[model samples]
Target: MNLYAIFAIYFLMWVISAFIMLPFGIRTPDETGEVLLKGQADSAPSNFRPGLVMLRATILATILFGLYYANYVQGWVTLDMLPGYSAAQ
Candidate 1:
């Protein structure tokens, strides 16, 4: 694929990875035994770290995108291989 296509696909993968990592490694103040700030939601995470989430998402997305690129180059899987897919006009 071209550079723009690769960049676009990788960006999509990164976004999906970020969303998948959002709920992991999170804890509410009550769960961590910390006092909640005024006006804070009850379920808000007291120790939320954007850096950690970004790091984890980057790693996950790299691995996933690597697999995707490999498949794209090798043609290991294709639309015709999927069940119920029809390539005819």
Candidate 2:
């Protein structure tokens, strides 16, 4: 893949990883035995750590993208392997 394609894929992977990592390690105020601030939603996390989340997301995205890139280069799986796929022209 080209540089732009790789960058785009990595960016997409990072965003996906960020969202996938968001729900984990969250602590609602009720769960943490903390009083909710004014205008804070009941489900709002009391100990939300953006830095940790970003770090974890980066790591997970790197691993995921690495596997994807390897598969792309190795052709371990391909569209032709999917059921019902047809490449006839």
Candidate 1 residues 4-85, lDDT tens each?
9999999999999999999999999989998988899999988889999999999999999999999999999998998999
CA lDDT scores, all candidates in order: 0.93, 0.94
Per-residue alpha-carbon lDDT of candidate 2 for residues 1-89, written as tens digits (9 for 90 to 100): 99999999999999999999999999899999999888989998888999999999999999999999999999999988888996663
TM-score of 2: 0.94
- Using alpha carbons, what is the TM-score of model 1? 0.94
lDDT value, residue 70 of candidate 2: 100
lDDT of 2 at 15: 97
Q: Candidate 1: which stretches are off by over 4 Å?
A: none
lDDT of 1 at 44: 90
In order of appearance, the predictions have TM-scores of 0.94, 0.94
